[model samples]
Target: MREIKILAVVVVLTLITYWGVEPFAHSQMHPHVDPANYDFAQADKVSAKEQVDEKKEALEKAEAQAKATGNEKLTHIPKSEYNEAVKFEKTINDFWASNKEALSLTGNATNGATLVQANCTACHSIKKEGFPPVMDDASSAAAYGVVPPDLSTAGKLYSKEYLVGFIKEPTLASKVSHKFVDGRVHPMPSYSWMQPQEIADMVAYLQSIAPDKMTDKEVFQNACQRCHGIKYGDMLGGTMAAHTPETNIKAYMGKVPPDLSQYIRSRGAQYLHEFINDPQKHLESTAMPRVGLTKDSEEKVISYLEKVGDSKKAQREELGPKFLIYLVIFAIFAWLWKASKWRDVH
Candidate 1:
């Protein structure tokens, strides 16, 4: 109860200090590209044809060599011939596959042959140029006739989740999204059977099978941006790194909160070096949580926070002019807003 109350007060003061200041991580960015589409049709044809051909060629060569072995028998031939025949077939298949094409399905498309059998064969057959439709429209796959979207570059076009989601929960996204909203609709009719995580993992593996140019930015924005802002300053108002008065922190916490900035600056970085390495050792009953941070992340966070002071120093030269401009703007806004209807709300 006591600690919670102290925590609540700290949080409240932090919020009050923040007022209307915006966090740094939120970007008013307009995205320039979409990554939720693929072409499974082309992929299926290439994959199926290549696999079937490899298997067929192996079996044929095996049979042919059996006839030539002069044992005059093919069935239970000597182990050497049988093994050689198998090896020859495998080498041929491997060489062909080395150049033919890699699996084109989405990361979640499937693994080895199992995924190939389930998703690839469902809508496509290996063929060149023309093929039966695999997707009738967007919401559903082709009516078992129209060519499935060419899958050769499906893995490359969209993200892993895009492919996996399309497979397990096609309704989430598809060859086309309009059908789900307001176009010629094609419903697959059922998908209550697949586990979400399995599909996600499958997609991850599929996407990784091919090369990718994805920046960590995409992953960060997609996962962490909502809860924690993107940039360092964005975490606690650009002011978080400021030398928040130890008095102020204590005022908020009912105890003399440690002055992180002073500890960082005066002890020649060593104080912070020890404090961050083990805060509990330096200050017992510290309100700071373990944060579950590892040594590396803790080091990185501390190093960056160390910048909180340096960044201020770097910007100090401009503060005078910037402050003047802000004062002018504040005065003008105050004058204008003083007469505005909103000012008299009380």
Candidate 2:
């Protein structure tokens, strides 16, 4: 009976910790957030189609209202809604969907090279083609507030759609619309005026030079090393070095980006996914812009993070059950020992 009482107390404490204390602590520490939608194609398609339809519907409604009121002009339409219709006749997403086919069109890499030389060499570099940035890292950072990434592996790192959208509108493609609002000019100007064939040719030129298969470290370098550094082991000195100095980044960004050495363990995978997809969703008005990595590229980058930050994850998972079994056996032996000691007391 005494043993049963002790066991009951232990169970009650465990239950309280598991059901009450743990939950309360977690709620305080990490508020609930929606899981990441890893399906970018589906999400982007649906969202873009919806926005286009909604805008078209609004414009049609305004026209109908104007017609009913005998006003040939859309004078009755709300100025804000009218402006939205006119300004965003086709969003970046819409443009991407419409122009996706151009990716397959045959293009001249020479022509693409000439076009890039003429327009892009001022700000960006095609290191693979021996085209260095017009300015060094310090000069570039001072001039543009951020060092432009080398386009050597951009074809492998980013999706074709993202490249197209970014070429069309850098602010919208990178999901930094908020930062560029209220007449704020983005550092990279919109190339919406460029012909679709020109955009496709640029993408083809990039794709021709990028490696077909990249290791996780390579993915991290191409996708994330421009801004975030990993200070784990040799990574800081090796693969995870940022292009620009930390001081320059801090001056431009107003804060040094955190070392991502332990971010996998600290923020967890889901938070990292959502945060990377859209920084403003997690931290409003943050300086970090959406990286626009494709699903595969994002996965590779996260996998590399896990490899560095949680190197013993597999070992820990394998040993966890063994430790639990040992604990149960120990508990039983302890109870038996206690019973023997108190055998004569009652």
Q: Give per-residue CA lDDT, model 2, range 149-236, as digits (tens).
A: 8888888888776787788778766767656778878778888788888988887787788888898888887778777888873334
Please estimate how well model 2 matches the true structure, expressed as its whole-model Cα lDDT.
0.76
**C-alpha RMSD for every candidate:** 27.4, 7.0
Weakest ten-residue segment in model 2 by summed lDDT: 34-43
Measured by lDDT, the strongest candidate is: 2
Clashes of each: 33, 0
Locate the minimum summed-lDDT window of 10 residues in model 1.
29-38
TM-score each candidate: 0.23, 0.78
Model 1's number of clashes is 33
Candidate lDDT values, in order: 0.40, 0.76
Q: Name the regions of candidate 1 deviating beyond 4 angstroms.
A: 1-113, 125-146, 174-192, 208-346
Q: How much is 203 displaced in model 2, in angstroms?
A: 0.9
- Candidate 1 TM-score to native: 0.23
* Candidate 1 per-residue C-alpha lDDT over 1-346 given as tens digits, one digit per residue, 9 for 90 to 100: 3445775898788886665333322222311221111233332233335445645566567667877885435434344444544554454334333322222432343453354446454564322223343543322211321223433323444544335434543532332221244453433433425554445544554444433432323322222221223233422444232122333434333454333433334543544544433333344335432122223334444455456434465567678889989987986686577558555674
